[model samples]
Target chain A: MLPLPVLEKAQTELVNYADSGMSVMELSHRSGLFTDIITGAEQLLRDLMNIPDNYKVLFVQGGASQQFAMVPLNLLSNSKKADYVNTGSWSKKAIKEAKKYGEVRVIASSEDKNFSYIPEVTSSMIDPEADYVHITTNNTIEGTAFQNIPDTGGVPLVADMSSNILSEEIDVSKFGLIYAGAQKNIGPAGLTVVIIREDLIGHAPESCPTMLDYKTHSESGSLYNTPPTYGIYMAKLVFEWLKELGGLKEMEKINRKKAELLYGFLGQSAMFQSPVQEDSRSIMNIPFVSPSAELDAAFVKEAKEAGLETLKGHRSVGGMRASIYNAMPVEGVEALVEFMKHFEEKHAQ
Target chain B: MLPLPVLEKAQTELVNYADSGMSVMELSHRSGLFTDIITGAEQLLRDLMNIPDNYKVLFVQGGASQQFAMVPLNLLSNSKKADYVNTGSWSKKAIKEAKKYGEVRVIASSEDKNFSYIPEVTSSMIDPEADYVHITTNNTIEGTAFQNIPDTGGVPLVADMSSNILSEEIDVSKFGLIYAGAQKNIGPAGLTVVIIREDLIGHAPESCPTMLDYKTHSESGSLYNTPPTYGIYMAKLVFEWLKELGGLKEMEKINRKKAELLYGFLGQSAMFQSPVQEDSRSIMNIPFVSPSAELDAAFVKEAKEAGLETLKGHRSVGGMRASIYNAMPVEGVEALVEFMKHFEEKHAQ
Candidate 1:
């Protein structure tokens, strides 16, 4: 969700950012304005996440899916074997890409439970020789999240936080790298935010393509080539807005309230059931299924009519999924909960 | 240059694009609306370029620079050798990347003339056994353009049209593949348009990164992952505007007029000189140096004060440059020509 304030700011400055007569789109990325934009976004994100000075934030393209490939390209070359925790479809996709580059071990998987829970990770499952242990912080389709980041011992932990980043407080030092596609919780699509420890870069074998090399982007400070200027500018605005809203601690407080509002309603609903296991349920994505497919269809249609849109679950796991990102206002979720109650009463068993 | 009409359309539809109640930025790339957007953009670009049925237009990210690496990673792995024609800085960059993947033969070069001219190419200059031949359709920094497409004699020819696509009419059927970063003639940065022949979609070497594989993008319709949604949407609008104003034939006519306006003035100027050879001069990027470096700096300063922006020439070759892309209006060139005349008269030694 692009917050209303973010939209207003972008709208007011669509033609020109700050005092520059050119739109952010027209500014040469080498220009000082753009340098400030990309750097400001990084600094804001760093402050918000409490990222360590050792980490470098690189703005890139090709989305999270590309990172699924890039992570392997840059990191896996150092240790061909990397431990992967398969929680959902995103995990499977990442593993498939990594296998092409090096050895990827599925150390633990919740696929047996239809990915409705996060699998328990133990030190035995982690290969000390492995370069990194990969995890999807939140599963958007299956409505699951890592309630606690697994202890990787000394192994570098990497995560795809595309679905839940910026919605809660996280220890930046806990993970060696964290990448998120910017469509959710951040700004727009097309921009991928990669926060990597400086030590992990430059290990890719000579066969790795230059663009996929983290070293290229890191050395140039994410300005190796022309970046998605407009997206980065929007992200900077979103970060500014996030900072103004009292950082992630405050963001988490509101997010938990909003998530609990809908989840609490689901807990009492007679006609709806959330598929996620209680301990691993995602606060960011709440997926529920009605007693009948016909009822679920009707509820989705009615919810759209009531201005609650994009409630349809991912096709891979069909039902209803409400993504309540940081930008989703409490009023929106409360309204959704109210609507769900009305629908439940009308179709109660 | 983002045309005022494009900006106006984007501004008016910034928050709710076509009554969807969501900004294009927030739209799910997999949603029907976004499908229409990405596909509509491809279709419009296909229409504009008269792309043949045998060709596929893939809207991938990472810009033309990424393509510089991707083209070699995917295509050159077959023969492990490719012929590259060096026209300017962009060509040199592409060759540098291609070398990392496989052997690149400099078939012909104009560096002897300080990249001020496009070298003539004959079929003999191409390595027929080479996987492909590479060229830059237009050099953005050095202000040189290939007035004629080289005859590769059945060798697949890949061209980077980042600075000149849509500004002119060309035979799309002639090249094996063409890619452009969207910042110039398309819409914005970060969106790379890759139009390739169906036959060249697959067959990357085993070591190729998944994201760098053209097949990954082509097979998924450039939707295998979240794409640069907003950039594609804006490109759609720009395409619509272009179609409304009579497509590429008309775009070419106006662009030629704009080019001639400035070039004609440069031709008559005594103190101002274009370093490019006449036959190889770029209609898109017009670079001219004054009699002295101080004079060139003064002109750029005065031009910016007069509302003309980003006229500084690339530092590799210091002077002043006016990038009059397809979005640049004839009046923009007229004003620049007028300013140059006034500056020349004032600084005449």
Candidate 2:
């Protein structure tokens, strides 16, 4: 759980957002209070990310899934084709959504390895005629993350950094667009944080809905439509929390420690096995399999009884996953590890 | 303010969503728990609206402003032209956004009358080649509302009912599409409620962004992108509340009484005047101007002192306005009327 003070402060305000004499749910997006929240959140985001003058950061709704289509809509104007690296479910979804709009070239993929690792893709492999190169920086479902950023030379590079955003520092100037859903490391699910190069705006096809036009949204300050108000408000709080915790560098240290402790325990455990390749482990999601599906079911049931919940893996994959997002304290992972050890000992007999 | 029970219940859950052991804000949209919320909300909405089997209701983000563009993108494909009735700010926005996609004809407009009344347009006035007829059922800022639905013959009729949705009963079969922002009579500011006819689906202009395509969102059950989980949850609660209130029929009766009481005071007051034409006065929003802008400011200041807030009008139209949504009880409006009476007498002396 998050700290009591932080949680309670947010809870109290959720019932009544900022002095509006209304719940955040009841406030109007066209109202001055909401516009302030939207603008303030955007400004604070720029400050926290140190986004340079040329990058347009949009506070869009519909998560990174929407960007799966939007990135191609805006970037694939001058060029008919784009290159994509399929890292996991999210990257695959990006590819699927992009195919509707343009010709997407698969530059690299880890599908042969069940997406347990990020494929190594070099800049030379990227087609020069391709409009942009798309990549999913972190694969939440498969528990794999890119340890290194891909080089796209002068080409526009788009990334879905949903799970691992703000958990580590990155050179924002390197990519053309970096989009993240705000549930894992940022704040919430509804808000999609998009940082796009200035030149990437205004290139949407005429058939693109006005709301999906990045240039229109950038010009209107993301208030072109009613954005998720409370989500943005909470994101602002999370940004403040990130800043107070010494930003991404400090977050990276803690995330690394948490991942190492959990992975170290899994490595030492005789009954438990991690599916992902050793070097490609994720810092956000940690998925592991037991000796059998029956054992996995029993393990999850016992873990839930022990207050370790939602450890079930995606339906496509049968295993257990522990998503230790930014909110999941190091102690939470320690508790999970301790629970796993006791469960393993009992099952070993 | 909403009743204490409603506020407290939401507050309790705002800190932690169901079963996830984390705030709804922290849950991933792809997670099962959040998906349940989205589907549950959609189901509740369908139940409350008695939505027919042939209609698809989408819980989209970005509110009705997004729909201003989407409606044209989807429906405008059938014809090179569309007819629009301009009543106020929202209708004006719809007309403006539609202009980007196709030729828009103003069948009738209240703008010449200062948008103080709803224009009376006949089906014969609608162009035979027009794709659809668009109208704003209620104007939030200008406080004008359509007392009757416009007839569009076979050419589809689309309505932007953002402020007045679920506030009254209407034949669902009458509209090709009805879209609403959730802040007023639905749930929150971020989530948009769109009920589109089945036959109207799959008409995207080829280059439309998937995020904004009604057909894509409908087919995917609004999960084409990550939805606003907590907002949808709140909307579910609101939908249940509407059901408990005996649906929109009962809501309309109570709403009528509330609006009459407030308007009664405005009509009798020597110090104030109604902004919109009285015949087309909105049951939801009542915008009235004092004898002077100074008097309007003073009225709002004194009204806030009496715990009657948000009575200040929009910046574009300088006056005092009161928005009496479904959540605002008739007693609240009565209290406002009493305060207005007291203020008028005090200022008259």
Candidate 3:
């Protein structure tokens, strides 16, 4: 979900952006007006994230799912082997895609426990000769997140941070590459933000599709064939909103408060419980299970009627999941907890 | 430019789409609301285009540039060779990308004439063993378009119709796959629409990235992952606006009138002239030039001051371009023509 202010700003500017008498969607990608918008967006993002000078921030399309293949295609030039941590469904998909390009070793995995936690990773687990180490920093479906960034010795680390990118502060130097879909903690879908170190920018094999090469985007500053113009504009507004709200550090406090309120209720409630482990819980997506499937269905239905939509869990994991991203106000969590309490009282036997 | 009505409707619904208390950007990809939006969009397009039942409409990302590679990757399974017509800059890029995947044979090209006209393509020019024959139906940069669809015998035809997909009526059955980036006559920059024959699907080799394979999107109905939700919604609105205006036939008439008004002025004006040959001129993008580069710059500046934006020609071609797409009303074209006449009079040599 986007910050409300960002959505409203987009609404106001949808038809005539900045008196140009054209929607952001209608502006030519090479026009000076759009140039300002894109450059301004990059500056805002760099300021918000405190991105390092060595990192090239690229705004491209196809989401993190596309990055699953791109990360391997562009980075697997050295050993053609990568170490991957299989935390959940997304990580498995990433690993499967990576296997197409090179040898993908599952250095660590939480699959044995239904992917309920982030697998521990150490320098010893990684292959020193590997091209890079891959991990999903947050699993939206499994409701698990890496509590700490793993050290991969001198090996470059690549992360799919789609679900929890801007929810917290992080050191930009921690990873060699970071990619995230703009749907969560950024803006809308269709735009993918890739923050890659300069050294990792041009390693793709010649056969790599020009659209998939980081060097193509880095050289063009992400203007390589109309880089999701409206999405970037929306992201710029989102970054502005985050900055106005005192940036990620302050946003993280509000997010943690919201997660704690919901998880605190779940910990005490007799009818509902979080499916994820305590230490591995994701502040972005919190999946919970009731006592029975019927109860879960009824709770999801009643919650929708109570104005809380999309509370249903993924089909693979039964029960409900609450994705309280950065945009979810603390009151939203409070409302969900209140509904849960009332339902527990009504269903008591 | 998008239809003004469509942009207005999007602005009105940007924050609370259909009273769902969430922006279309915030909707879950798996939600019923988004499913309706996407399905409704496809149906509207089918109804408007009269697309055959055998053709699947896939709303994918990465634009036409991405499809340059995907076309060969997915279709080159049979002969590992394809035919291409180099009409302009875009076609050259397409050929270059396709060369990475297979043997790309350029059977026809207008490059000998500086891509100022579309070259004729006959069935005899096509290699029957080719997996697919590629063409750019309308060249945006060079102001050229095929007046007639080429007969490629049994070889499948793939088109990059990014600049002119919705501007006029066409026979969808003639092409094996038609892909267009949405920024032109559709809605925005992020979403790409691919209409492919069922026989052409699932041909990508296993090494192809899951996101790049047509089978993945075709099988999942373009919901394999989070799509550009808001862009799809905007495109749906555009389709509805087109349907309201009597579909493609009416849109074609209005577009023709706009193009005629601009081109007619250029024909009569002594100072300005269209570079494209008349028979191969595009109704979508019409590039024109004044007597000198100084006059061209002056005209572009004056046009901008007169509230005409993005009239400057592409860098590869100097002077001016007046793109009169489906969304450009006749009044806009009339205004451009009026400004052109005034500039010509003032700068008479």
Candidate 4:
């Protein structure tokens, strides 16, 4: 679980934000209190990512789902064809939304393999004249992740790291744009964090709505319209918490340990089988299935009674999923492992 | 000075929303906790608006600013020109944003009269071929309001009622669409409420972003993306409070009394001058200026010492403004009157 101190501080301020005598939710967007929260949240985000001066960090609404449409609208300039590598549900959704705006070329997809592994995309698969290349760095639903980013050559590289952001270290300068919906590893869901290169602004088609325009939101400091104030505020706290824990390097080590422990238990157990290939298994979401769907339901039901909530996998893929996000304590995982072992043994017959 | 009960309730839940055991800001959009919130908020809005069976209410992210663009994208179908009556800052912004999508004809404007009154429009000024006629029922920044809605003559009439929504009574069926940002009267900013007639849906341009497409959001019950959960929750409370106060008709009577008291003071005071023409003055925002900007600033500074906050006029107009929203009690208006009378007596010379 997340630290008590951070949650307590957030709780204290939730009722009254930064001495404004109003909850963060009640503060007016144009008020000085909200200005501090917005500026502080942006600054903290920039610091967390060591974001360069050339890249702009925008805190927008609609999570990464909306960005699926915005990315093509803003970046698919000079060419109608954009390349997308679909690893899971989110990536596929992104590609689907992009189709409405432009021609989306699926350079690679793991759907044929039930999204168990990230497909290898060759340079030949990508159109040389494509406007940009998009990829999902982490497949939250499928429990897979990209071990290596594809080579886009000269095209701008865009990645959605919603499920694994702040859980590990990464080279921020490599991608032209990176967006994460703050739910699993960040703070919440409504506040979407977009790290876009400065030059990508103002390229939206003439018919693009003002709110969906990157240039408009970026120019207004993500306050062009009223932002999700409390979500950003909590995200700022999460960033501060990450910094206190020695940034992403420490986080990466802890995450590796947690994943290793949980995956080790799954691999050694004969009662369960993982959905994703071992090499491509996600460090955040671990989806596993039993010999039958009935057994999977039993596993999830027993786990919830044992205090492991939300263990049920997505309805599309009926199974069990253990989401060990940044807030999921190592002890919590250990407890989950102990429970999983007991449950497997009890149901072995 | 909104009521303290709802704020207190919201303050308590700000830390943990509806027994989800986490702050509303921390819940995932896909999580059941948030799904219930987003859905419940929409249902609450539908109930409050007494929305007809044919109308759809969408909970969108960006404030009315986004609707400015989306309205034209969705409703300006098969027509080259749209009619707009420029009543205040909001309608002007809507007209400006709409120009990018379609031709706009300003049927009437009060700018020549310093925006102190809503101009009387003649049917001759309206283009019958226009796809939709848009107006801002209440202008927050200018303290001007449409005393009477012009006849759209069977054409769709849309309104941006950002500042004055839920403060009075109106027949929802008369308009094709009504949108409001929740900050002023409804609750807070970030959550925009859009009520659209059924026929207005499904006309968005092919290039419109999914998030800005009214039909897309309407179909998903605003769960197409992660909506601002806390904002919607607080807005739900505000709607409940409105219902408790006996709905909009009762609210309109109380609102009229508050406006009359405040306007009566402004009309009689020798040391102050109101910007709006007497007949067209806003019941919500009352903007007044002293002999000079310096005097206005002093008046504001002194008024704040007496616990009268946010009385400074909007930056566009340099003076003093008292926003007596639905939440503002009659006692607060009396207190403001007392302070204004005291300031006038001391500074009249």
Against the true structure, whose TM-score is highest? 3
User: Candidate 1 — what's its lDDT?
Assistant: 0.90
Return the lDDT, model 3, position A120: 82
- Candidate 4's residue-wise lDDT over A25-127, tens digit each? 6666788877887888788877777888999999887778788988998888888789999888899889989998788888888889989998997777888
lDDT of 1 by residue, B1-349 (tens): 7888988889889988879888889888878898898888889999999999999999889988899889988887577899999988889889998888789899899999899999999998887799999999899999999999988989999999999999989999999999999999899898999889999878886666678889988889988888888999989989998999899999999999998998888898898889999999899999998888888889989998988888999999899999999888998888888888888887776
Model 3 stretches astray by more than 4 angstroms: none
Tens-digit per-residue lDDT, A1-349, candidate 2? 2444456777878666777667765566676787777777777778777889999888887778778878888899877799999888888888988998889889899899899887898989999889999988878889998888888998888889888887777889989999998767766557788999998899987666676779878998787766777778777777777778887788889989999999999998999989999888889899999999999999989988888878999888879999988777889899999999988888896
lDDT of 4 by residue, B1-349 (tens): 3456777776577555676566665665677777776677667666666778899888877778888988898887887689999876777789889999999999889888778898987666778898999989999889988888777777888999888888887778888999998878877566788989999899877777777788888888777766776677777777778888888888899999999998888788898889888889899999999989899989999997888888999888879888989988888899999999999888877
Clashing pairs in 3: none
Better of 2 and 3 by DockQ: 3
Q: Tens-digit lDDT track for model 1 on A1-349?
A: 7998999889889886787867888888999988888888989999999999999999999888889889988887666889999999999999998888788899999999899999899887899999899999999889999999889999999999999999899998999999999999999988999999999999988766678899999999998899999999999999999999999999999999999998888898788889999999998999999988899899999999988899998888989999999889999998998899898888776
Q: Which regions in candidate 2 have their CA more than 4 angstroms from the true location?
A: A1-5, A16-21, A27-40, A128-130, B1-4, B16-20, B26-40, B301-306
Model 1 chain B poorest ten-residue lDDT run:
B203-212
Model 4: pairs clashing at backbone N, Cα or C within 3 Å: A1-A329, A182-A188, B183-B188
lDDT (CA) for every model shown? 0.90, 0.83, 0.92, 0.82
Q: What is the TM-score of chain B alone in each candidate?
A: 0.98, 0.95, 0.99, 0.95
Q: What root-mean-square deviation over C-alphas does model 3 reach? A: 1.1
Error of 2 at B170 (Å): 1.9
lDDT of 2 by residue, B1-349 (tens): 2444566677888676675567765565666787777778778777777789899888888778788888888887866699999887888889988998999998898888778888788988989899899989899989988888877889889999898888888888889999998767776566888999999989887666677789878888787766777677778778777778888789899999999998888777788789788679899899999878788889999998988878989888889889998889988998988898888889895
Scored by DockQ, the top model is: 3
